[model samples]
Target: MEPIQLTTAVMTIVNASRIIVQFMQNQRLKNQARRRQQHGDEDMNTDFSKATVSSNLEIMVLLGQAHAVERRFWARETSTEWWDHIVLQVWDDSQWLRNFRMRKGTFMELYDLLSPALKHKNTKMRAALTDHKRVAIALWKLGIPDSYRSVGNQFGVGKSTVGVAVMQVANVIIELLLSKVVTLGNVQVILDGFAAMGFPNCGGAIDGTHIPILGPDHQGSQYINRKGYFSVVLQTLVDHKGHFTNINVG
Candidate 1:
């Protein structure tokens, strides 16, 4: 054979061998990628199954707790019988006055005046208290220096309920009667009465007292009075009849 032809044949054989080797390497890489994808899919499915099971268990536990709470009943110790049987039926007028600081008739009158503002309607959840009862509760709380819990036991109501009643009645009284009840009322007569008592040109008697209070958020130290207790000053002017003519509180 000629030397040029022999060299050309050798070059063609080498080129063919390179192509075959490159094809085999590409096929091997594809197989490896396929195996990796199958393993990843299996791991993802297992993780999803575990998460679903865990979520289901949490939901079941929550449902069981809800059912248990619904079935449970919590009863409280109350003395409604005392209020209904003794206070209303057995207590006399003097007893009423002693406890409430007002005669039964006066209490009724006050209730009649405040009923429109203090009344609450009965609902399916509970029956509303009578207007007279509400007034009595307020009067008892204001007349005595007792804790809300103590007052609640006496009235056969919850402590929180007693607190609510007192606040409601007090607010209503301030809104409806403060202006009419606490007034100078015949200024000339007041001056004349004070003059007869040897106080010249005095329309009323002025006095100040410290009302005990919880420490306030703003300037709490300022509320500490000389007596070493937190309090606000209440200044008042009263006429000869001892009716409040003017008042100031801080």
Candidate 2:
């Protein structure tokens, strides 16, 4: 044989492998950050169901845009498939299948809110049984008014149950949204807004209104404004610049 140069070639290959590994690590971190930005939310917590987590992650990845179509829903990979293939393979062995319907954060909130009422042994209705489905159905109906009866039918409950569920979820959502999105003003901000309109002393303005309802039970008071029928008088307060301050919804 003429010559063999295995050692030199091996060293060069090892150095190249190290550089390649570092590049891949950097690329992966950058990809994770880009993914976070694309979704507009942080990554999931550790305790979340693996199947649900994987399903959500795959869905988000495949369909991240406004008009993204879900291939998993079309039949390739589903929650059930993910549960069978990946979730069960993990050692923790959580009930990822049943937990698939609920996002972990929402599930946690509903569980905390309804655990007391649901824990009662005497409770019989479906709503009192499972807070996960109840909360989901409630949220779905709030945005889709027409689907109330349909969703109720699916759950073998009345439309009123759906309404109640939705109202509960809506109340929680409203409270959270108000706290986070609504910017509260101190006495200074209020005074500044009023001062802009040259009405510093005026705390607010009062306007009288009436809402017509079924015929009056008393059938005597004629002070009920307009509509030529039974109505309740309502007084609303507005700020100097016409911002609504308060309303006595009688």
Candidate whose TM-score is highest? 1
Q: How many residue pairs of model 2 clash at the backbone?
A: 0
Q: Candidate 2 on 1-250: residue-level lDDT in tens?
A: 1133455445455555655565565556556666666776445322223434554554454333322322222212212233234443552424432433444455556557654443323333222425655665664554343566776765555667678877766676556544443333355667777788887765666888666555666754664555565677778766555655566656
lDDT of 1 by residue, 1-250 (tens): 5686576556555555654554565456456555766777666555555655665565555445434422223447566777778877898899988988877778778888899998689866557877777877888888887888998888877888888999999999999999988886998999999999998799899999998887889999999999999998999999988999999999
Judged by lDDT against the true structure, how good is candidate 1?
A: 0.78
- Tell me the deviation in Å of residue 197 in model 2: 3.4
| Leading candidate by lDDT | 1
lDDT of 1 at 137: 80
Model 2 spans with C-alpha error above 4 angstroms: 1-188, 198-200, 216-224, 240-245
Please list all clashing residue pairs in model 2, or write none if there are none: none
Error of 2 at 209 (Å): 3.9
Root-mean-square deviation per candidate = 24.0, 28.1
